[model samples]
Target chain A: MYVTLKDGIHDPQGKAVKDALSVLGFNGVEQVRVGKYFELDIAETSLETAGPLVNGMCDQLLANTVIEKYRYELIEK
Target chain B: MYVTLKDGIHDPQGKAVKDALSVLGFNGVEQVRVGKYFELDIAETSLETAGPLVNGMCDQLLANTVIEKYRYELIEK
Candidate 1:
């Protein structure tokens, strides 16, 4: 699952990163947003079934849906 | 740049997140590895130039090359 701040949400961390880049002489950088990515190894065999299961995980704890948006890519191993 | 724990590098945070998922009843989760994702808005027009610049960022501070591997995708806006 990929979790990122929702659009219009203030991202102080992102701004801090941007400021750091600027200090490093990477003045070309206009913005920088940081996010969390999770690679989940799951027992489910198909995405169709795992979708809701993982969604529930995110809804419950993996992400704060009110301020963060999340999406997942399921790959069967 | 995406920064993640190198294989064979112990990830305590990942373990903690996995444990949390297990407690939350997402038993289907076999493993969970967390990582940092950065979206950089840059002034450079071509990846060829931005590539080295961003790589410098990662090499200098964005990632700990000894225990973390980083890769980036260049998207034109």
Candidate 2:
């Protein structure tokens, strides 16, 4: 799961990171926004079943849907 | 860029989030590892050119190469 701030939202942590990068002499980047990425080891085997289950997890627990949006990709392990 | 703890590295924040989820009654998940995701608006246009530049940012400032690993995708914005 990836949870990122919606566009137009201010990201103070991202700004701090960008400034720290500039201080470290990396000047090639801008408008850095930060978010959360989760690597989940779900008990389910099928993507068909896991999708909604994970969505429920995100909706109820993982993401704050008001200001943040989330996306997930399943990687077979 | 994404910054995640290497395998076998303990993630306290991830554990906390997972515990919070369990407390909120989502119990079908396990091994929930969390990481940092960055949406960077790089000044460069070409992926070929931006790849190395962003790699430099990760190496120098974004990721702690010792315990964390990073990967980035050049999204056209």
Q: Clashing residue pairs in candidate 1, if any?
A: none
Off by over 4 Å in 1: none
Candidate 1 achieves a global lDDT of 0.87
lDDT of 2 by residue, A1-77 (tens): 89999888889999998899888877777788999999888778888998888888889888889988999998776
Question: What digit string (tens of lDDT, one per residue) describes model 1 on residues A1-77?
Answer: 78989888888998998888778887888878888988889898777998989889889988999999998888777
Q: lDDT of model 1 at residue A1?
A: 79
**Number of the predicted model whose TM-score against the real structure is largest:** 1
**Each model's lDDT:** 0.87, 0.87
Computed on C-alphas against the true complex, the DockQ of each candidate is 0.88, 0.83
lDDT of 2 at B2: 90
Q: What share of the true interface contacts does each candidate keep?
A: 0.90, 0.99
| Cα error of candidate 2 at position B55, Å | 1.5
TM-scores of all candidate predictions against the true structure: 0.95, 0.90
Q: C-alpha displacement of B77 in model 2, angstroms?
A: 4.3
